[model samples]
Target: MIGIADYLDKQLRDYGIKEDLSILDFGCGQGNYTIPIAQIVGGNGKVYVIDKDKTKLNQLLVIAKKVKVDKTIEILESEGQFDFDLSSESVDLVMLFNVSCCIIGQDNYPEFQKLIHELHRLTKKDGKLIIGIKEGKTMLNRVETGIPLISKEFKLDKKEKGKYLDGEKLRNGIFYSLTKK
Candidate 1:
């Protein structure tokens, strides 16, 4: 039932990122996976979790306090628009977990391009972008459209589909990771 979070944590640990590494979870919903990441990064690291919905973030703040890791999370309310207030080349790792399509929607809106550009702008040269989109979604379409908006922004390293069991059933999802190149 909790396969996604476990799998994501395993993948992140396998990468051998530093404990003090700065991470950003874009469109983090309810801090499900974000909390685990925050725990792994430890007190020395800074994990910035952003969601467009302020109420969801408020709930996460409460949960974070309960877990006593609230200090590590810089929860912020941000609209999924181009005007994301962040300095360039700042973050080391950015996780776009099931969040990109949710933010831009399926109307072929150019904001997807702006989002990718902003993420790229906020990433260091060696930063990695980890994205997990649903099986049937607009991420691929957004990728097609995003090419022209920001040339050489990011390169898709690998993508795969797998089933994680959920209550005696199989729940399928697609996972993809990219790096700024």
Candidate 2:
């Protein structure tokens, strides 16, 4: 069985993530994708992980150390807001995998657009924003509304079908790559 990390590594490669690039793993949970990304970017790169849960952030750091990629990772505990303490256009890639829906709720569609704008602000010119959404009608519906806002700052590069291990079951998902205009 392909594990979540392996699955995420494949997806990152498909998105053209390479060595020496800085990355922001927004809403990074337990270092699933974050660790693989650190490996891919190698020692010359940096992976900044942000999550609301401090415990999860600690877990991520532990995994990074276990994998010997701790030096390449920088972590921050977010307060469930869009404020990121980083300079504009400083990162080469922003991974919003499985984080869109959680950050954007049904009652706050406007806030979703604002977050997209913030993501755009954080991304370097021509940098990539890779969004991964779980394959389901409800999740799709929730994210569809923000497409236009994303389109305003990014060009739709491509979309691919992928799978992620959710608990014990592998769930299908869509990965959207958008390049900053």
Predicted structure with the largest lDDT when compared to the true one: 2
lDDT of 1 by residue, 52-156 (tens): 888888888888999988998996557755556777887899887767667557655467777877889888997888766666645667644544454478877
> Candidate 1, which ten residues in sequence have the lowest lDDT sum?
162-171
The TM-score obtained by model 1 is: 0.82
Clashes of each: 0, 0
Candidate 1: misplaced stretches above 4 Å?
1-5, 15-18, 137-151, 163-170
- Give lDDT per model, in order: 0.72, 0.83
TM-score of 2: 0.92
TM-score (all chains, Cα) for each model: 0.82, 0.92
Which sections of candidate 2 miss by over 4 Å? 1-6
**Per-residue lDDT of model 2, residues 40-89, tens digit only:** 99999999888898888888888788889999998855788887888899
User: How far out, in Å, is residue 63 in model 1?
Assistant: 1.2
Instruction: Give residue 35's error in model 1 in angstroms.
Output: 0.2
